[model samples]
Target: MKKDKEKVLDEVWTEDRVREFLASEPKAGTDADFHALLKAYQSMRADDFELFIGMFLETNRNLNATDKAGRTVLSYAKEHRNSGEHVAALEAKGAL
Candidate 1:
């Protein structure tokens, strides 16, 4: 039970906010915008990284590949203490 609770904590997510933000995109723009969205989403839920990681990986070929916003995955994660898992997920997806 303790381990289960810890895993849930490591999961890190404020689901409602993250979902709403992701759903509110313009649908077409520079990869920078997409990166920003992913950055923001990951910041919210380090554990619930599926949405952002999947978004990037699914469109890997189309992704910006560079964070023009001058932010790195770890840098963004620094803003959200709960985002450790999210940072890991983004790294797995190849977000620089």
Candidate 2:
């Protein structure tokens, strides 16, 4: 039972799940979208974040999205600890 619970907790976020959440919004280039991406970046592992970002971009989501304070997802990834991989992924995607 404990192992089952742990497995559930360890369930990975799929591209479909990411799309479903983003699709809830009317548009893609909103501050809300940026914030959501920021939150996901902060919470997800480096590899998972890369996958999420890839899926996000695949759906035509904004890669250069910025928050109200004018912070881009690239900025957030750069500042995050152990996010070197994430930053590199974002850069490859042209996240400036």
Candidate 3:
């Protein structure tokens, strides 16, 4: 059991893994997908979050997706504490 836990922790998130995870998700360009990404972004560390975003873009996921209220990932990052790196990453991707 301990070894299983350790192995799980040792697992690295790959581009294929990211893509697989998104496969069952709502359409890539949908608001639901954007919201899902936002939730993941809020939970991840800056580096991992950046990688996720890169994978998202590589899969042709929406970069400038917005919520029903028109709130975007950038706007959420700006509102989040210690999210400067996240904001920068999103901005570098032309998120608005």
Query: lDDT tens string, model 1, 1-96?
Result: 355444344444455655544454442543555555555664555445556556545544322343556555455665876666766766676566
Tens digit per residue, CA lDDT, model 2, 6-92: 434566776666545454442445576686677677666667777877777877788887876788988877876788988988888
TM-score of each: 0.44, 0.68, 0.69
Deviating ranges (above 4 Å) for candidate 2: 1-30
In candidate 2 the C-alpha lDDT for residue 83 amounts to 86
In terms of TM-score, the best-performing candidate is 3
Model 1: how large is the Cα RMSD against the reference? 8.6
Query: Between candidates 1 and 2, which one is better according to lDDT?
Result: 2
- lDDT (Cα atoms) of all candidates against the true structure: 0.54, 0.72, 0.72
TM-score of the candidate numbered 1? 0.44
After TM-score superposition, the amount by which residue 6's alpha carbon in candidate 3 deviates from its true location, in angstroms, is: 15
Better of 1 and 3 by lDDT: 3
